[model samples]
Structure formats: structure tokens, C-alpha cells
Target chain A: MTALGHVPGPVGAAPPAPEASRRGLSGYLLMLPGTLWLAFFFIVPTVTLVASSLYDPSGTFAEGYQMTWHWQNYTDAWSEYASTFLRSFLYAGATTVACVLLGFPLAYAIAFKAGRWRSLMLVAVIAPFFTSFLVRTLSWKLLLSDNGFIVGLAQALPFVGEDFRLLATPAAVITGLTYNFLPFMVLPLYASLEKVDPRLIEAAGDLYASPFTALRKVTIPLAMPGLVAGTLLTFIPAAGDFINAELLGNPRTRMIGNDINDLFKSSVIPTAAALSVTLMAAIIVMVLFYVRKAGTEELV
Target chain B: MTAVASRGVRGWLGNHAVLIFGLLVLLYMFTPIFVVVLMSFNDPVGRLGYDFAGFTLYNWKNICEPYQLCESVGNSIKIALLATGLATVLGSLMAYAMVRHYFRGRGTANLMIFLPMASPEIVLGSSLLALFVNANLAGQLGFWTVFVSHVMFCLSFIVITVKARLSGLDPRLEQAAADLYANEWQTFGRVTLPLMMPGIVSAALLSFSLSFDDFIITNLNSGQMITFPMFVWGSAQKGIPMQINVVGTIMFLLALGMVLGGLLLRRIRERPTA
Candidate 1:
């Protein structure tokens, strides 16, 4: 075939500059499969969920529920699960703050301080995640149990009492959330931090700024995009997470996700759907507000 | 002079403080993993209790001794592989289109791709379940439903990963290929596709892991299907089987091996090429 003949060419031939092809039909054609997949599976399902949330509260699936445009379902759901919603946000906020505190240093060390070991440290950061998440959370259960070494260590600490238990408390839930989502925070921080010029920090040092001042003024501003991204990533999922609460916390620490999950299980589909939609809307609003306040427009 | 020396020492300690704190954080992250690995070896005296007793290899030796654990693992692998393949293919094409072409609705397309990642897992899972229930397909929720959800979630991640790699690529190489009188197909097959391999590979790996590790979404839509995560959840309520740790350890080692192996292979390839 003549087509095959064109494969081998003169190796050193200086080819002409590549001409920009017209914005043709192939691009749209190429996008068709994936876009259709997302549209059907993601977009359609989301619409269906919203519709289901408006179904009559009194009607079961077997009884053929009608969509009466019930906005009251949201109100009912909210009144029933408002505390759970507030608790989810609280836990998520705490987790996000904790992740920032823990992940920033680790990400900074990997980006700037690890030097030749940077790649290895990066790998190490993600290596633990290869284990199943449930398993990891379960191990946390073991580690935080009353007689575990972690509890013993905490008991030995100056502020902590001998009677303080870490497991099945809000502290345990928040700890699990922080641990599980820390990588999400770290990876983005690393990405943004790696791009910052070392000279800026050096210049700050040369200008007689202390290390803390240099970090705050020079490094933190440059890493804002990553920080915003990291916080959003950490907060959103942490808010929705029932796994940590279910495994690590007592009923007192249950979050909105637990309520949604429980409601769905109990065949309260309309209420569950309403709660899910509310959770998503609340998160989106918070995210939009935070991103605007943080002044990072590139994330979307 | 003493004050000056002490100040200098204090500053140096402050400089290295972040690194020390970082290492401590790393240690904290690995603490539970160590417990899991250690627990895997523990021959617990009772029915899969959390307490560590004398170490033995019995769990490793009889990983499938627990009822349906191996079956669920097999199901997870099957679903993960299927979802990864489907998502990677679909997502890479979408990423390619987004980056390489000046398409209309690009902004909307980007938003669509991003929405799933931004949305909570609970919403996504419940929505899919709701869709199935409304369509009267609720009774049929099983492997196929789980498979579909896995693909949906994994698609967003794949698209993002590959798009990052695609956007960063220098187009000059493809231009050079075209300048050599190569057709679009030849140029793509020879230059563009080869260059995008790393992105595609990483995306596939990400997709596989996401699908494999997903619990919340799978739990909602899976009906009676017991993927590994669902199995773990079910078992956690009853006594957890010690064999789960063996599986966990194996997954960690295998993933670590694959990543390191990929790095090694890339290094080997780049050495001569460079």
C-alpha cells in the first residue's frame, strides 16, 4: 500500500511549519462518545434525582407517587435533619483546617526541601492510599481504640487526661476525615508550591525577613490557588462522607450523609433525595463564595 | 555574644521546623497502615477482634477462608477493570478533543466534565439510584448499575488527569510530523498518541483505583452486588475477617510496585532517548 510507503521518511529532513487545521467536524465527532456518556449517566441522573425529590411525600414507589411540585419536602427534610447538616459542615470545616495545617508543611517539604528525594517522597505520600479506604478507616479504629498505643500516647501527653478516649467521638470522626482527605490537600499544594520560584523566598530572606515572615509573605500568596483548590477538594468530600462517621463515631457525631444514607435505606426516597440536593446546593454555594472570597478564578 | 549565638541557633531551628513537622505528619499518615500490616499477622484469639495477639501467617495462608470475601474481591476487580477501560477510552478522547481542537461549547463541555468532580459522592450515588428507581430498573440494580456508576465517577477523574497532560503538551512535534508530509492519522499515531501515553496511562490507573476503592456510590446503586468495599462494610458490622488485611496489604504492595515500575521504565526509556 502507498500509505505504508509514507511511514519511513528521511530522518534529517527539515519539515515545513505545521499549518493550523481548520476547526473542523472531527473535534465534535471525537467529543460525541464521552459527552454522550456523561450526559446520559451524569446529567440525566442528576435531573432525575431533582425530579424525584419533588415527588409526593406520602406516596411510596409501589403506590405510584405523583410529582406535585412539593417544595415542602425540602423544608420537611431540613427541619428533620438540620443539626446533621450543621454537623457535617462543622466536621468538614475542621477537617479542611486540619488538612491545611498538616498538608501545607508536608507539601512544602516535598516541593522545596526534599531536593533529590522529591519524587520518592511524593510517591510515599500517595502510597498509603493504595490500600482500601474502608480498611484504612478500620485501622484507624484499631489505632484509636481504648487500649491502643495512640490512646496511651495521648493519655501520656500533658493536656490529655488518662480517661480521654479518642474512638467514637467527634474527635475521632474529624480525625478520620482529616486523615482521609489530607492527600487531596497535599497534592494540589505540591502542584502550586512546586511552581513558585525559589528566588522569591531567597529575596525575602535577603531582605531580613524571618523564615515565618518569608513563608507568609512570599510563599503563601503564590500558593493561593493550590490552597483554595485543596481546601475545596478536602471540604466537599469530607462533608459528604458517612464512612468516617459510621465507622469512627457514635450516633451523636452523625453527619448529614448518615441521615441521607439512613433515609434512603428506610425507603424514604423523597426525603433522602431532598436532603442530598440540599447538601449539594449548600456545598456549591459555599464553594462559590469561598472561591470568590479567596480570589481564585482558575479552579472552575 | 551569647545572645547572638542563641538567636542564630533559634533561627536555624525555626528554618527546619516545617520539615520536622512534615515528617511527623507523614508518620501519622502511615501509623494506621502499620497497624493494618501488623494486624494481618495477628492470629486473634476471638472472632476477628481488633486486639493484637501473637503473630502468625494463618490469615495470609487462608485469605479466602472468610465467606464471600474472595468473591467480592473478584467482583471489584472485574468492575474496576471494565470501568477503567471504558472510562479511559471515553475520557482520553474527550480530553484530546478539549485540548487539541478549537471547538464551540468548550466552556460548557469543561463545566460538564467538572460538575461530577465537584458534586459530592452522596449526591451522585443517590441520583443514580433515583434514576434507576424512577425508570423501573430498580429491581435490576446489580453489576451493571454498579459498573455504570463506576464509569461515571471515574470518567471525570480520567478527563481531568489526561486534560492536564494534554494541555501541557507542546504542539510543535505534531506540526513537525505534519510538515514532513504526514497525514493527520500518521502524525497522530506516530507523534501525538505516543506523547500522550503517560497521561492516558496515569488516567487509567487513577480510574481503576477510584473504581476499585469506591464505597459510597457503589453501596447505593449496587443492590445485592457485593463489591469488595461493600463486603468490607457488611463484615465490619459483624466481626471483620482478618483476611481483609491480607488483601489490603497485597493491594498496597501491588500498586506501589506498579508505580515504581512505571517510573523505572520511564527512566530506562528516557536515558537512551535523552
Candidate 2:
């Protein structure tokens, strides 16, 4: 929080001279546009969100003119959104687990076995991201079609009877989340694993340590920071995202995103605001929990 | 000797186990996207998919047939470009100021700028909606509202990218330029500009992509303006048209091509330079 006096103070090696004053003025001028944009949009809007939530139920301004403060807005929305939040949490959590279970191995391979192709593999992980998320998701819809080739394949499975429906299901939403966020998990894990010293593992072996013990003690602990960061990165977006849930999930399995969305569309501003605040708070709490459990500095 | 050899075998299995698991993750990550790319070719006519329909360009043709796709695409391109440009310039200046100059409420400013990034897109859309309604601004919804919102969203990304680059840059470069008779403008133009170009370009590109792909904010803000995503949303409600799959496939392929091209260029350049 550089809310304190943040100024360029004796930054350059140049002997403290007449130029210092000029440089500071120019710098301040340079910063003005961004400062204006932030204050006008970010700060003002945040203030608006809080004030809007407090507006009485009759409307904040003239009756129905604006959101009137009603503390109950939060409580009312909570019951509606509680299951939604739980569903979102479950989807997000499942995605995180899926990424770790799926991503760690690929990361390990790239870091160790696929040495020369590591860059190419890394690029592949990031490649899908370059394209439109909407497009990629739409493709999932196509592939998961009842008569689509993927389903056709599923039907071909032994003893599997009836049409296979992949799209419009909770599993589809989870799959989409995992598809989108796997890269977040893999990249960080790769970064950490790549730096792991092989000699240390050898040293452990020389001390008669079992292979399981070596990995459990050395690799897991050392990679804990990346794992934590990756989990946070995946979990936050998965929980907050409305895209996957919208595209892949049916109405029966609405997540918190759907709840917020309904509120927004219906012009239920205060309740929507409360839900949003809760969502943001949840993320902050998760981050803090991880930090406390693993220590802030070590957990990335 | 036997013990050592057994230890070697155990290490191999341990490493291989991780590798197998990693491959599984990569496969899962890829499968859905891969499926999308593959299905983009299938001609969808409601309950029909990939029947050896013998690949048709009809979907791409359909883009301009019944909808204002060209208009939406053009609008998307224009709005994204303008938003990217605006966000880049303002964000870079702010980054320079925060990183290079003294400013009061710097922490407050940083938090303020980053706030939009943390809040959900819907909140921003709603807040802007309220702001405009209260202000009695013309056009409750349209391209302008969308553009402004895009700019607001892109600003955070640009600021983050530029600030990071600014933080890492050596202040000495600017000082030296100034000492040698360069004015503030000249120093920034010649010295600071070149170093920040990579970051600035990346930030711009990222914002452009974001603006182009945006759905939630656009859906909320647009009154009648139909962007590519709006078109997709409407079509999706009726079950996605094959045109979407075709368009999506093309976009994904294009992205892949650019990435491969970039990699090839890097390889060739590095070979010569090294």
C-alpha cells in the first residue's frame, strides 16, 4: 500500500542535483491519466457498489429511482446463492484436483523426459489460450453432442448402452474448467520441478532413503510453493467463472455465477453486489488460508 | 553393485510415474479443446453432426447470411482496437509515473486500478450502468458503452504489464540520457520507449484479445449492438450454428499458426545470432 508518500526519492546514482525536481514533476505528469482513469472507474465504482448495497429496498434514490438500502438484500440473496456457491466450490475444487492429478505428470515429463521438446510442450500448454475461450468452449459443445463422434466413441464402449450426453452436465462444466486452467497449474509446477536438483535425490538415495520417501520429503515440499500458487490461480478463476458453467452446465446445476448473473439481469443490484462481495471475500479468504497454512513467503 | 543397480531402477520408475501422470494432465487439458477444433468442421443442422457430411464451407458462408455478423465482427475489431490503444497509452504513462515519478496516494491508485480486475465483470457492467443512468448519459447501451467498458477492463492488464516491466528497468538509463543533454521527452522517447516496447506490445495484444472475446460485460452493456460473442450467444440459445464451429475452428487454427510461426522465427534467429 504505497498510500503513503510514494515519490521517486534519490533513485538515480546521479549526484543529488537540480535535475531531481524536474524529473519528479515530469514523472507525476506522466502518471496523471492512469491515475484519473483508476479513480474515476475503479475507486468510484467500488464506492458505488458498497453504497448501492446499503440503499433501502424501496430504492436508494427516489422510490425505485435507485437501489434503496436494505441490509436484508444480502441475507435474501445468500439463501438463493448458497447452493450456487457450494456447487461452484465443488466444480472449482474438482477442477483443481483434476489439474493437479492430470497436470503434475505432464509437467514432470516436460521437466525431465521431454527435455529437448520442453519448449514445444510448454507452447502447446499455452497455445489454446491464444485463441478465443468462447470458441474453444463451443467446440466442446460440438464434441459432446449426442450424436457427435465423442459420444459415438463412448457408445462403442463395451456394455455402454444408450446415447452418451457429455454437454449440459456438471461433468462438462468441470471438464471445461480443467481444460482452461490446466495450463495455470502445469506451468508453475514445471517451473518449480525444472529447478529441482537431481543430485539431492541421488544424495538421499545414497543415504539409503527409499524412492517414495525421497519424493514425499524432497519433491513435494520443494514444489509446494508452485503447487499453492497454481491451486490459487486455478481455484479463484474456476470459482468465479461463469463461462464454463453457462456453456456446459444445465439449469439444474447452477453455480454462483448463475446466481449473480440472474441478479444482474433482473436488476436486483443490491443482492448482486452482496453476492459479488461474498465471492471476492471467498477468494481472499482462500488465499489467506493457504498463506497461513503454508506460510506466505514459501507458498508463493 | 546389485544394490546400486536396484536403486537406479527405483529412480527410473519414480520419474516415469510422474511423467505418466503429467501426460495424463496434459491429455485432459487438451482433449476438450482438441474436440472443439475437430468438431468445427462438422455441419450442424439440428440433431445432425459429422456424418461424413464431407466438410462444407457453408458455415462460414452462413456468417453473413441471416445475421449482422460482418457488422459485429467489424464492431468487435474497431472497439477492441480503440480500447487497446487507449488503455495502452494511459496505462503506460501511469506505470511510468508510478515506477519513475513521485506521486501521492500511489498505493491507493494502484489498488484503485487493480480493483476492476478483481471484481466480477458483471459488477463492473452494472456499476457502469448505474453511473450512466444517474448521469443521464445518452445511449443507455451501444458501442460507446461497450468501448468504455473495454477500456476500463483493459486498463488493469496494461497497467500490470507495464508496471512489471517498469519495475525491472534500470533507472540509470534515463538518468544517463538526461545527463548527456537529452530532455525528459527525448529521454523517454529514445531510451525508455524501446525497452518498454515488448511489454507494451504484449499488453496491447492481450487487451485486444480480451476485448474481442468479452461476453459478460458486452451482454450487459450492449443495447442493440451485436458483437461476435453476442451473435454466438443468440445462436447458442437456439443451439449453436455450424457457422460458430467453423468460425471457432478457423480462429483456433489461426492462433496455432501464429504461435508456430513465432517459434520458427525465434529458432532461426537464435541459430544465426548464437
True C-alpha contacts between chains kept, each model in order? 0.65, 0.43
DockQ of each: 0.54, 0.41
Model 1 chain B: worst 10 consecutive residues (lDDT sum)? B163-172
Best by TM-score: 1
lDDT of 1 by residue, B20-110 (tens): 8888999988888888888899889885877988889999999999999999999999999999999999999988887787678977888
DockQ, 0 to 1 scale, candidate 2:
0.41
Q: Compute the interface RMSD for candidate 1.
A: 3.1
Interface RMSD of each: 3.1, 5.0
Pairs in steric clash, model 1: none
* lDDT per residue (tens digit) for residues A1-300 in model 2: 121112223436433322223344676778778677767765676666666666565553233445445778788778867888888899989999998888777776776667557778887787677656777776676667677777789889987877557888898888888888888798778877776665566667788888779778887787777788688768877887788888878887677877776676676667776787678777767776876666532332
- Cα lDDT, model 1, residue A49: 88
Q: What is each predicted model's overall lDDT from 0 to 1?
A: 0.88, 0.72
Best by DockQ: 1
Off by over 4 Å in 1: A1-22, A290-297, B1-12, B272-274
User: Where does the lowest 10-residue lDDT sum fall in candidate 2 chain B?
Assistant: B45-54
